[model samples]
Target: MTIQNRERFLNNVAQHLGRERKTKNVERPSSSLMPQWQVFQHHSQDELADELELQCHSIHTTCKRTNAENLHTVLQETIEELKGQRIIASDDSRNETFGISSLYEDLQKKGITCHIWNSADGQYNLDYAESADVGITFSDITLAESGTVTLFNNSGNGRAISLLPRSYIAIIPKSTLVPRMTQAAKHIHEAEQEGHGVASCVSFITGPSNSADIEMNLIVGVHGPVEVTYILVENR
Candidate 1:
């Protein structure tokens, strides 16, 4: 939308609400009582990983820990256990750092079809992801308290790569593990303050998709992947 049009729309809304149009950004208010900042704040990385696993169990998602040396084996075993035939992975460079690039080549040699996300391909990415047995991507930040993995979306990391697949796998670096959403938000905010570029869209996925409707009927896999797994690896 054009700036003029947006301003006019805001003015109209302000008129209806009996308030002046806000022309300048305001500083966010601060609270003295921030219990969120204290929860698990002092936990070590190992402790955070343990709490992450505990939360994963409650959410019905599998969490595994492996070092860089054994990540390839653990990933391969997980895919074999899932019986994945067609896999879709994000075009993320971290996959290479974690040895997943070579692993994909090996999987293809073993007759498992694999596709890495290509933004240029456009709609084909979506079509393939819809039929993919599994989707794999690296987590930007992981919340230990809720078993959540944060994905910052971009052209290379499309939303469909995580949302459309039958199953999803998040490769979590130990350094990315945080106490909760509060820490995650702080990291992003700090990045912004440091003039770092951040993705416009961020996804916080806790577990397999499930919903409880008005009548409290629980349904799983309604809007996204039926199964989700987290593979935690020590990055350093």
Candidate 2:
């Protein structure tokens, strides 16, 4: 942001608060009780994965386990189960690392259309996502406590890849698994401190879109994907 815009934003905030904008930065208070740092801190990776699976049931999401070697086969099977015809996937390097690059070719051989997100395509990306039967992405971070997947969206992996498709699939590596959002935030903050920066859009998706009406009738797939499947890849 420009200096003038930054000052304008602060002025607007100060006016709303009925106080003048302070020139100096204020030091934050620290608490002695830090439970967030302790919850599930001792749990092993395997234990975290188990917790993720257990929470998935409550969130109305399907959880699948696989290894790096079988990821391609398992993913293909999952696409078939979802009856996906036209697929849209993020152009994430981790996909190639986990043996997914060849699967796209195999899918094409079977006449399944797979469109990888391309920045050069511009509007065509959104157009493809709208008609896509399934959208696939690799989770940057997996929260076991809430069965949530964190997507650090970028030019190559746009938010539409996850929000516009009928069905969604997230491939999570074992190393990205964390106890919850606490650890995820910490990782991002530390990365920024180390000059690694962060994605402009970080999406935390738990499960398929759902809502309840005034009558308390629960509706699924109201605003997003009708179904979501999380594939946890071990030893990735």
All candidates: CA RMSD (Å): 3.1, 3.3
Candidate 2, 1-236: lDDT as tens digits: 54558888998999999999887888888999988878899999999999999999999999999999999999999999999999999998887789898999899999999999999999999999999999999999999999999999999999999999999999989989999889999999998899895998899998998989748988989989999999999865
Q: What is the TM-score of each candidate against the true structure?
A: 0.88, 0.89
Best by lDDT: 2
After superposition, the stretches of candidate 2 with alpha carbons farther than 4 Å from their true spots are 1-25
Candidate 1 whole-model C-alpha lDDT, 0 to 1 = 0.92
lDDT of each: 0.92, 0.93
Local accuracy of candidate 1 as per-residue lDDT tens digits, 1-236 = 54568777888999999999878897789999888999998999999999999999888899889998899999999998888999999999888788779999999999999999999999999999999999999999999999999999998899998899999999999999999999999999999999998999999999999989858987879899998889999885
Query: Which pairs clash (backbone N, Cα, C closer than 3 Å) in model 2?
Result: none
Per-candidate clashes come to 0, 0
What TM-score would you give candidate 1 relative to the actual structure? Answer: 0.88
- Residue-level error in angstroms, candidate 2, position 66: 0.7
